[model samples]
Target: MAAKTEDLTELSNIISTNVKNYLSHVPTPPTLRPTPPVPVTDEVAAEAREQLLLACRRVISLVGGPIETVMGMSAAFHQTTAMKLAYDMKLAHNVPLDGSPIALGELAAKTGASEETIVRVMRALTLQDVFVETAPGYFAHTSGSAVIGIPGIEALIGHWTDESFASAPHISDALRENNFQPPEDSRKLAFNRAFDTNKNFFEYAYTEDKPMGARFSQAMTAAGTARGPYNLVAVYEPLRAAPKGTTLVDIGGGIGHVAIAAAQKFPNLNCVVQDIGMVVSEGRDGLPEELKDRVEFQENDFFKGQPIGGPGVYYYLRHILHDHPDPWVSLSRPISWEKGDSLGGILSHIASVMDSSSRILIDEDIMNEHMGPEGNKMTITLDFQMLVMCNGKERTEAQWAALLKSADERLVIEKVWRAKRNDSGIIEARLA
Candidate 1:
């Protein structure tokens, strides 16, 4: 035990040193950094961030004694609770924009939350470095609090706090009821169980509350923005390689963000954004003035036969496949996939319709081989989140290769394009 304590203390010192080293180079909080922060796209900054993340994980691993460790695990719910309260109350919005500290009473009055309650919640969040008490009974924005105010970020937080937080606790029961198999039915997953509904997550989000659905799309955009160097297009080689007039189909692309970005960047490329009727209509109506001639919207159920198919057409699926099990891709033809299945099925069907030179680009998290304490946080968190909500999963490179092979014997992995700053990899497959 003495040796263990000494090792932990040494690890703690290493963490402190690394953190100081990082701050020396990047003096400002990421939120306050210039629009398109240098650190976000810089290779050196990314490497430093990775090292800090690893050290933090090492520290996290040494957190408490047996009883304290168990209690700490149980207390994980507290962070979610505090985040939800602050977001719902718009407490972050109440903070001074210029970074000046505000008295606790003044902030409470601005947000209309009880001052005492606000104090408790804000103080709890401060423990996470979300907000800082600059002086007694006063609060100010830290990097975290400031960033939460960005459009779509608060929505992402809202989605997690309200929707995801409610469902996470039910994962154990969902598994037990499903015979310990990762469920294949979206309607039977923990999200449905928590909501006491048979509808899938998207159906509930879209049909139940239009605003919520819009927020989800916005949240996705925010996520893309946060990825910096890993933004969908930057990691896709095929898009860069495309000649003028290349028709790119964005399957299940919401609001055509990726397509719009591509169209704006590569003037010669024509994009077809496909999705359900509602989303396509929105994308079509909101199509930026400049992209009007270059990008078009189409309502096509991906589960059904891909409507636009020809030789040389590029198909892009960003953050789509992991939502369901492997079997749904092929079944998309016979029936709508209220439940999910593998990418192999859809890949096979698409491959059947493709011209010999056509390629498919899959943008998603490629789980690392060794996921220890310092594993990629987004990938690790989302893997379990997928299991609970849609019975889906994140795949590794080997798994991606296998899935593509199983989808079409003629399909071969062309290449994998990865960004220096993000966890996602773009897997390219082409007909052999």
Candidate 2:
């Protein structure tokens, strides 16, 4: 026990030192590091650093080692039966976003599943705190589940639960199958064998009346409507404040959350939300009676073409590019080398309409293999889901830059910003 404690302490110290080094190089925000009336004394600054390091050490000790935690998560990923049950219960219960207590029988009824099945599933989820049982057979939601409840969460979950994602259930298969890339026919074969159908997973879900499809739509709306409204406003604030007559086009915007947020933030700025007809119709129904006139939802399939011609402040593709692999390249190529025309085509379309001043902001994870075990593992997991569902793949910074560079000769990346709410990153590109 003493030895264990010493090991934890040393690990904590290492984490603290690394954190301090990282923070030291970043320019402190003016609000966070306001100009002091008097110069900061060395002794005071040193003491502050010590306090910060101690706090970091405490956090590290509490969380345990990064490697250990990652290994544990990898192990958990291998154990999917538990996750699936938790997902089912959460969907059935109508658990509040804030996570109030719920009854299992009630959830079972709502989901149209048997009580025994629900109970068994809940047992597994409760173990992981995906759903917390306040009492035996009674559960409550958590922040983790609440986030998962957001509209897009269902799509993500549905994609994962599909047989395509399940065929190679072992993590070793994921790692060993050259990061889970198979030839196109072979990939299709795996999926068909799993589902006993040739149809893609999404199409299959749509046909089978999987609640996950609608839930996915709602979850996407929840995530976008909640974080998107504010973040969209903030991201476009610079453009909003720019010279008048600025038109902003939201590309593949599901239900105009970003556009609505922008309109609310800057009433003077003109905005349009472009998406598929089905999504636009759904969004239109849910729009506040007042904002319908102000915000227009246009039927535009970004994969084919963007209808909005822009001399706009921003052409934003939020969480869209990550859903597609490089277009022209065959799916068999190493995901890193698979350069395609889909993303490039969209950017080219946007560029054709842009003036020299227009900008493009892509909100997605700019994966870094070296960031830490948490990010790397999560990204790879997500990548596998993408492969199974949509033939899409996540891109690293170099991959993103390469795509942007190839998309339009006039476009140049200005900044890559990280989100405070999640591990997502925004790659901001401007027409040079």
Candidate 3:
């Protein structure tokens, strides 16, 4: 009892300090409304807010007791189910944005869902503060529910709750089938198994379920835009000093926005954005007239040897490597990677094309060795999401080192420009 009391006091202290720090910087108490995630002008305030939120979670877990914690975890799926139903019924749009609440029956009529169903779902959401009960039987939007109004957010929610959620339960079964490999092939994983499809997740998304395909694409865009740490600012210093006339090949870069930005930032350097045929066409067509001369969109697969090669060239891969299984080099001994298997095929191709003066810059989340709730909720969830949907696995710093060394004995991680706020970083590799 004494130890428990001490732990509770420590948690309370943390919460009190962080709350004061946040208020000192912002001078405003947060309300149940949407606002910018971070105070744009104040990094200190942003850090404080993050700390405060983390401390609150810790406090909740500490006080809630083991039974309550486990029960909440077990029933967490109820929230997702409610959210998905709400989304399908277009609940966000149904709710009046003018701070007026709609009665249960009226909301059901508008959304074409049953009043009974709406009542139960709203109850689940309201307890979570997604929506609030303005009166005895009326509902109003809160910050949590209001986010569904954002562009692409609905698709993201739908993708996760529908296809992704369905696949997750079968993960253990897929693991058993694959003998518990850290990462199994996409065809053998939970996604393919759940959907009864022989094609990979991407193929199934695009072909089998067109709506899901569209949702996945939009969700990816939404996610890409949200990762502030992975942007060009993270590694601008090194990129600024590159030779005036060098080629930067963005392998598997989609739609070429990053390549376009790179070309605009560094006028003297040429940029080549490479992807599949459809993506290359879209990127080429979208190129601004000013960057036409410096930026080229080419259709090429990374698994095959790099089509463009030479000295003084830089190969850029953003969020590309984490899509495949890892430890391409066998832990037992040095061995060549199988064709089209893991990062081995991809890395070997890049290694074969690189000259002594060339470099491979991979922009990815460099995960920690251990997944701690205080530090990492996003990356750990993402790692599992990748496992279920595809054969991908996020690599830690040590895992990256072994994989790179296996690709080529000469290849070395020259430097890593880690983001200040997150695991996102630029791993710069060069031939030793």
Clashing residue pairs in all predictions, respectively, total 11, 10, 0
Stretches of candidate 2 above 4 Å error?
1-6, 11-79, 86-120, 130-213, 225-230, 328-344, 369-371, 374-380
Best by TM-score: 1
Clashing pairs in 3: none
In candidate 3, stretches whose alpha carbon ends up further than 4 angstroms from where it belongs are 1-6, 26-29, 34-41, 182-184, 207-210, 285-289, 327-344
Q: Write the per-residue lDDT of candidate 3 for residues 141-161, one digit (tens) a residue.
A: 877777776767777888888
Tens-digit lDDT track of model 1 for 261-355: 88887777899988887788888888889888889998876765677878789898988888766665423322225444433256766777887
Tell how far residue 99 is off in model 1, in angstroms.
1.3
lDDT of 2 at 22: 43
lDDT of 3 at 211: 74
Of 1 and 2, which scores higher on TM-score? 1
CA lDDT of every candidate = 0.77, 0.59, 0.76
CA lDDT for candidate 3: 0.76
Q: Rank the candidates by TM-score, best first.
A: 1, 3, 2
Q: Pick the candidate with the highest lDDT.
A: 1
